[model samples]
Target: MDINAYSARLHRDLYAAGQLGGEDALVLAEKMANALDPSIRLVLLDAMVEAAGEITEGLAPGAVEVRLAGREVQFAVTPPAVAEPIQPGTAAPAVQPPAATGSEESEADGGTARLSLRLPERLKGRVEEAAGAAGLSVNAWLVRSIAQVLEAPTVQPPPAAPSTPSPTVKIVTGQHITGWVR
Candidate 1:
């Protein structure tokens, strides 16, 4: 298929899916114009339009059906059952992925700093006890502690003052030092 033709179709689909406005369509067109390959651009546009349709339609059900290329794409904006709407004078619950807490690095050998700290025996024992009470392993407890420390920045030490000269200095005569006394 001709990439230009496909790109135009994708743009139309996005508009019909109620996922993009005229300005957004123009922005997408600009991006497609700058793309390296027309086919890749068309594919990306299609994916984006489809994903946007899913998300927006899910959020605002029965809003409208978008018309594109003599066809209409119908979408509903129904939210998840557990997603409760915020009432007046109330804060909306934050929408974050529940499973995105720790180290979601792509590669196995991801560059993460590992610090080995040797605290006093008493402190170590306390940490162990706390970890046991919280039903977490030692490693987990250490990770939590490190995270807390990172969240609260360290108090930097005050800068040192320049050293001053001593009032007097005594010179002891020795075999190795006897050569030069200016």
Candidate 2:
């Protein structure tokens, strides 16, 4: 039941079968065992060992040997079976859609998108205080504020004259005139 020892043996077997090289097999085996669930680890390991046997069988006699779980295993390689050609009028297999999972169901019901924001500490504290006072979550308060602003009508100020005096305007008879008078 020593996982490290088992992993080492598997690595050696895989390397000997030419399926993997030294060091690579060790790293691969260690990673696979660690990443997979304990319940399925042994099953995956068994499949790997089986594949190694098949791979060793294809090699020249005495080229490679596979050992698994402290026992030597034999293998024989056979020619690949020929696949039948598809007919012109044949219909291809239909693909099925993936099943909906819990996360997908929750997303559909809530219609909510998660957001991660990086805000200044002061701003974040202010938002938290406002949300608490309003009896709403920070997310809800922010969404409501944004929606209100977006839905409100925008106002624009009337245009003003240019700040600089126009060069065309000049004094005529001691009074200002927009244009030259003769």
Candidate 3:
């Protein structure tokens, strides 16, 4: 089987599945052809071999070995040394801060950040309903709500006193008041 032909067919199939345009598919196919990474090629070959095995199962079963034209190379990789376990009563070493990178700075400067939070199902449903009612996306609604809460004043002035001076007045704690009467 011609590898180029197989690759081209794979590209078309992938483009169709992905719903990509003709020009995009052509570009992607060209990239794939140029790359020709061994792992990806092996994966395609493996799938084909598996399918062939299924087809030939009635004729011969048990095990199948695939032979490919390639030179074998071997290299020894030293395993990383394991750290000694901490003895009982010994304090663990402090963790050092990670070195700052360009990507981290870029992420901080208006770049999109992903936030994943686990909320109760009931709360999530309520938030989604509120968001729909407000004609805003859930993300937008949450952002606006958070901003409002942060911008609101923590304390408010006492409310204005009535014209008739009562001997004693109940001091409301939680309510937002305006003025303090002397």
Candidate 4:
């Protein structure tokens, strides 16, 4: 990843905030931004390294490594090796009916339901990376994501307020005029 992009976004936000202080403050902010770029870049790199370490811990045999190569940041991730690697053309295991249980079956059923999911190698890598970043196990991340997608919106949007006429600008007799249109 290009660390410069993060630094640039930080610089833009800083300069925009400086606008609130007027021209003189903006000038000083610009100068400060230039000086802060290097330091901010290092901080961003450090954060990515820390996040990678956290992800690696949850992955066990799978690992995530953050490497800085000159101006760019690179991630090297190794997914956990499957005991039985599926072939390219082979179909994954089909879903099976839930097992029969005793009187306590309803309670167990309400707790956890398992599904066998098959993901391509590249996509699997990305999913692992995302899960690691969020500091969640792959199962938890998938469950949360699926729930979010399936759940209906709980909060309805507020009704829109009546629109008010916006201000307009006009040039009258070589003088600028600004006022509401109506």
lDDT (0 to 1) per candidate: 0.50, 0.51, 0.53, 0.71
Alpha-carbon deviation at 156 in model 4, angstroms: 75
Cand. 4 TM to true fold: 0.46
- lDDT of candidate 1 over 5-123, digit per residue (tens): 55566656555544445777666655654453456564555665557544433343212222234222333232322556789999877786422112322123363344568989999
Candidate number of the best TM-score:
4
In model 1, the Cα lDDT at residue 103 comes to 36
Candidate achieving higher TM-score, 2 or 4: 4
**TM per candidate:** 0.25, 0.32, 0.28, 0.46
Model 1 has a clash total of 7
List runs of model 4 lying over 4 Å from the truth: 85-182
| 2 or 3, greater by lDDT | 3
Better of 1 and 2 by TM-score: 2
> Residue 41 in candidate 3 has what lDDT?
70
In model 2, which regions exceed 4 Å deviation? 1-26, 32-116, 157-182
Superposed Cα deviation of residue 9, candidate 3 (Å): 7.5
TM-score of 3: 0.28
State which candidate, 3 or 4, has the greater lDDT. Answer: 4
Encode model 3's per-residue lDDT on 8-68: one tens digit a residue: 6766666565455577766776666557646557776667655643432322212222345
Candidate 2 accuracy as TM-score:
0.32
